[model samples]
Target: MENSRFWRDPAVPFIEARDVLDGRHVCYARHSHESFSIGAIVSGHSTYLNGRARHRVGQGTVVVMNPGDVHACNPLQDQPWAYRMLYLDTPWLTELQHQMGLGAHQDLRTFATTHSDDPRLFAGLNGLYATLTNADLAPLAKHSATIEFFTLAQQCLDPLPQRAVLAHDKLGRAADFIRANCTGEVTLAEICSVAQLSPSYLIRAFKQQYGLTPHGYLTDCRIQFARAQLRRGRAIAEAALDAGFADQAHLQRVFKQHLAATPGHYRAHSSIR
Candidate 1:
């Protein structure tokens, strides 16, 4: 039977979820997105294409795709395939890159291959999908699970660098401005003015120099501020607003993505010592 389930939360706007696809036989045409994507094969087999390369993937396989990396997947023969996937917006992926300490001047870093048979990644993704799709779970819990899952995934699947060195000074001023105004709404024009660069050039240069776009950098800073607030025993909702998040759920999502722990958990654990 062909079945699919999707989920989305306003707070975690940067992520779109296909929580499950069961017994689907639809063949997908070559396509690309402005977002990064990852899929976990739960059962059956399929042919995976990335750019000009092709490979067969089966149960326990993890597929990774970067933004605009043309790819598709279709079942071999009439075989049924079940899977779960997450589509992460570029800004979110950029924040992840920064969290992983990839540094500026690097392009999007992702898995070296289109797909991997690594059991760890499969298990980690499976767990994340389950947590994310479980309606009974609290936002904080789901956020924590998501972070933990990606942390494991990143550790197991070594990230490959995709670009050569670039100038860092170009965006230094813009980055500083964003960091300083991270807890507020910082506009693009403000950043461009500070950097003495045009919007387009600043966008490119900032991403190149910081491994994150200006908005991503701002989000990172807000997350950091939120973490400190949580550690200081601030209320979650208050921390969210104070840290420039739209709401507590947004804070939970971003915080978990970066820290692998929810604000509540972080506060609780921090208080334990």
Candidate 2:
């Protein structure tokens, strides 16, 4: 795990991420993912092969591979290399295209940019990787940040940009529903129905419009609910359960993740003030 690391969260299922800190010994046979793949060379050099084309890539180079596109990267001359990559589920990305008004029919389309050295793109990809890997961030922030990054990737990497759909405020219902039921399990289906919005639309645009995903908003609601319980001198375990977390530990983890403080610390401090 020292040289290679992978990050995934069920909360954000549309994407998977991985990185290689030292790829000199790492090698891949011609391979493909059913998902859309994009990556950046963080440091070092390697030979990139896509279809019949081969190119020498170095730091700052960004590469892309569509679903089923056989490609591989290997170190050149046994030299040290490093990289970070993201694999995005095709359906999720295509639906995002539809939300962006890329086509009348929501369907996946191929992008032509095989590779580039755009500094902005390189920095964006790296930033996204960092954000996704940070465990302390809330799930809503993770998912929303993902959508924002991928949206940027599409418009900036594609040779032709699509016309963006006009903004809409239909997400309020979804937010309200989430707030109303913050202490309970809520599905994407439930939110979509309430908001009269597609999953992709809600996923990508909700944070843009409201500054938080329904899940993030729900988490905040739960935290606030727990805070109220704690103010009444209730037990932390009881507060967590009432707030819809599995148990005190679960709530403690999420509480620390969002607030960077333990429930005990918050509870003890609140009593003094």
Write model 1 residue lDDT over 184-263, tens digit each, in one string: 88999888888789988877776655556677777777876786577567999999999999999998877756533467
| TM-score of model 1 vs. true structure | 0.57
Model number with the top lDDT: 2
**Which residue runs of candidate 2 sit more than 4 Å off their true CA positions?**
159-273
- What lDDT tens digits, residue by residue, belong to model 2 across residues 1-273? 455555666677677777778877567655445678999999999999886679999999999887645567888999998998888988898888888777647457667677889888889899988888887888799788888988888777872344333267577677678878988899999999988999998988876654456676677678768865765669999999999989999888777654334677656643110
**Candidate 2 global TM-score:** 0.58
Residue 168 in candidate 2 has what lDDT?
Answer: 72
Please give the range of 10 consecutive residues that has the lowest summed lDDT in model 2: 158-167
Q: List the residue pairs that clash in candidate 1.
A: 105-208
Model 1's alpha-carbon lDDT is 0.71
Supply every candidate's count of residue pairs whose N, Cα or C atoms clash at under 3 angstroms. Answer: 1, 0
